[model samples]
Target: MNFLTIFARNLKQGPQTEAFPLGPAFTPERLRGRIEFNADHCEGCRICERVCPANAIRFAKTPDGMTFDCWHNTCVFCGNCEFYCPTDAIHQTNDWDLSHVNADKFDMVEHGLIPNQKCVECGATALNTAPVIKNAKPPLSAEEYTELRARCPKCRAKYLKNRKVPA
Candidate 1:
């Protein structure tokens, strides 16, 4: 088409683009935007940390509990953490407006307090995190259930070995 014809057609269809920052912003469905972490649902699995392509997720072990930190600036919006999280703790929301002056503000940190089960024999701490207790499988007897409660792996092994019953 000629320049005049194209110009007239364009003039007839005015403001083709959506007005953003002035009006409502539109994001596509199933868009992976930002990371939303629910500490209550988390079991300290660390699967999200291992699967993160951007290395945005960091796990810090504290005396009381562990902390999960995610930096938005480093995140590539790939939704790897959300997919890898078994507990459905990490989710990718549709809020993509992550602009910030101070980068520290974009850092989201979730702290989870996981109580270690003390070994009955040596009184040592167990390595099992939240998921172990929450997602415990059944078919275990009362004695087995009690035994699986909190003892460290080493002590649990020894305890199991001494027991007449096989776990």
Candidate 2:
């Protein structure tokens, strides 16, 4: 067809696109757009730290506590961390509104993680105060080697509660 004829045909057809920043839009179901972490469920094994292909995931710990960084700007979203998580802690949420004006704001947090809260039950240390272990597996498994992994005596008893009433 001639250039003029083609141009006229194109102009006759309406724009087939969605308007943005003015109307509510729908994100596709299969479209991957964001990552999320549940800090409470995070046992700080840092398997996510190990499996990340982009080197975007990082962790830091002092005598203080632990924190995780998704670094979404650099993350390729391979979901390596999500699959490798033994305890099913780090997984993606369906909230994909991640366009941020500030570069640092892309750091999506589990937020309200109490890194400084003291262990009220024991004078020793709480999950909040300290997160990671110096050695990966201890001789005692923190408190004891149980079927459920590294759970302290007090925590275990609370978990394995007596459902049956004793006469």
Top-TM-score structure, candidate number: 1
- Model 1 — which ten-residue stretch has the worst lDDT? 130-139
- Total clashing pairs for each candidate: 0, 0
Q: After superposition, how far is residue 20 of candidate 1 from its true place, in Å?
A: 0.5
Model 1, 1-167: lDDT tens per residue? 59999899999998778879899888887888878888756667789889988888898776655767887778898988887777788889888787766756744543344454567767886544533433334345667746754567666556555656436
Please, what is the TM-score per model? 0.61, 0.55
What stretches of model 1 exceed 4 Å from their correct place? 1-14, 103-129, 132-167
lDDT of 2: 0.59
Per residue, candidate 2 scores C-alpha lDDT tens digits across 1-167 of 59999789889986657766677677777666567777766766778889888887788764555767778777777878888886667776556776777865655544324253443334345444223333433222434323223334355344345313334
RMSD of 2: 8.6
Prediction 1 TM-score vs. true: 0.61
Q: Counting only residues 3 or more apart in sequence or on different chains, how many pairs clash (N, Cα, C under 3 Å) in candidate 2?
A: 0
